[model samples]
Target: MALFFFLTAQSQNKDLPDVGIIPKIVVKAIGVNTDIQGIIKNDSNLFKTLSSELIIISNMGAKNASKAEQKDNFSIAPDEVKIVATKNINVADTDNIIVLFLIYEDEKLIARDRKELRRQKNDPNVSDGLEIKGLVVENVRSKVGKDFYDYFYQQFTLKNPESDQLVKVEEQLGIGIGTRIQIKVQEDLVFESFARPNEEQLVNLANSAVARVLQYFKQKERQKQLLRQF
Candidate 1:
């Protein structure tokens, strides 16, 4: 009977729908704030890398959806893509921008996305309260990750797109992978009261956020796989 049950379980597993249908996605372009030189360059690079990773996952999901459509003998439209920018935080009185991509179909929303980088501060003594600033910044980054994930999930559901595979692709891609890239202040623009803040701290914070996002994505994907198995 034990062997019989084991064989039954194996059969059940084989009967389960495969979650491997999701295709890889590629990210081409991400939008950023153009006002600050330091912020813009760093953010652009960050988004570019992020976009490429997401594209791989999205393509996976899209492939799954396309297959489903083909099986049903229906047409699937191309994903609607757009990049959105918003001011989510302020540093030294300068607003920090959050850039994200949106994938949707017609009036329906599909996926909401973002890659964030902090804006450079011009204020003298900005680094004086580094401890306090760090704490606040950390919290902000956490919130950003949570918000981003929630938005993506919500949009994904709304679109009702074919595949649930790429939901957790963020984890596999290492969303926040490196040190916070900082803008160099020109020597001629130096302020006597200023102390240069360490960019490494920001980079660490960014990496932590990226790690969280990746984990979140992986978790979601696992959940979807479980659902399909049943």
Candidate 2:
């Protein structure tokens, strides 16, 4: 039986993913209100399921500025800019996290037609006459969460020691000996607003924010892979 088990273990080891020590990661969710809070709380179960998962940072908030700044003749910084408000949530099972973020900066709010143009024509520079730039809100919960999960999953299956007999023996022994995992995160509110003739700018900015989060994950994955080779 021992010999039979040894042979089986050697064969199984060959098929196991070459994953080494599970890489540590920093999980961070960026956005205002529902987008950030809802996703983290919703995936609380998944976090618990992953044995080595560490939520280094979560529920970061930012404040939006409500004033405008004039730069070069062609460009204007939105009056209201979003800035990070606070640190990550510490307690577990906290729900409905409310995080305020800057959605816009200083820029002139304009109307589509001339109906209101006459009123502003006489007082183009009037502060009261100027329109308020709409508030920009975004949710970034799912993007951050999924990125962390996928990266962890890939690392787990890729660098760990492979041994069929060892796996079976470990199962029979009922001992837990596997890869170690860690996580860390840094959250920041980035500006993605435009004072233009269309709404496409805001959409593009939000997309950019999500892409940044994905890029962060990919970079970390590469680091982990390099570490495993040593």
Candidate 3:
């Protein structure tokens, strides 16, 4: 597994100083018999499963005043992996911006590859319009009883596809298997939802969580714009 992250920006309107910044995350999976397609088609919890099987080590540095972002859309093929990077992430001028990637595949226990990227400086002030801190699964419980808690816990925990950040989750008593997702920007909550713990439900949970995050930022930006008029 190998991945790269790129941060760049461009002007959308010539009249205004507003810039459009877009960052990209690219990944490539290589193996003799890697079941990439099967995972995508069969398992609905792709991100969660992958996170369990592989540990992605990533780091970024920017000389420019900017923030990096990850896109919501994710797809993978045997050939390569590509993803939208950031709207706020800035790369510094006169210095080589670096993003290091280290991928490890579980079960196989093979260290695949490591990559370091140097990106050019670009405008960072403009809004990329994406502000999703991360997604997390929490408050796992079994409605029936504690007997099936471990089984459901294994199914409910999910990885935030947009970012590699994990927070602690606590066990709670419940009448059935279910989880609540809390999307956050730093420590502030942007969105939250509770749902049954199943494959289809898990899918809905992730999509709904992402939608809330996006909507929260959109409304926040609107409020900021309204205040600027004053």
Task: Please provide TM-scores, in order, for all candidate models, with all chains considered together.
Answer: 0.20, 0.20, 0.34
Candidate 3 stretches with Cα past 4 Å from truth are 1-6, 9-177, 186-188
TM-score (C-alpha, index-matched) for candidate 1: 0.20
Q: Name the regions of candidate 1 deviating beyond 4 angstroms.
A: 1-197
Q: How many clashing residue pairs are found in candidate 3?
A: 14
Q: Give Cα distance to truth, residue 191, candidate 2, Å.
A: 7.3
Residue 201 in model 2: lDDT = 41
Of candidate 3, the 10-residue stretch with the lowest lDDT total is: 31-40
Candidate 1 Cα lDDT to native: 0.25
lDDT of 2 by residue, 1-230 (tens): 00000001012223333222112111122221111110111111121211111122222232421221111212112221111122343222222122222111133221010000111223433332212111122222333333333333222222222211100000011114321112223333222222222234433433444444345556666888999999
Per-residue lDDT for 108-154 in model 1, tens only? Answer: 33333333333333444333211110011111134334333333332
Model 3 — TM-score against the truth? 0.34
RMSD value for candidate 1: 22.3
List model 3 lDDT by residue over 166-186, tens digit each: 322334433454544444544
User: If the candidates were sorted by their lDDT against the true structure, best first, what order would they fall in?
Assistant: 3, 1, 2
Candidate 2, which ten residues in sequence have the lowest lDDT sum? 1-10
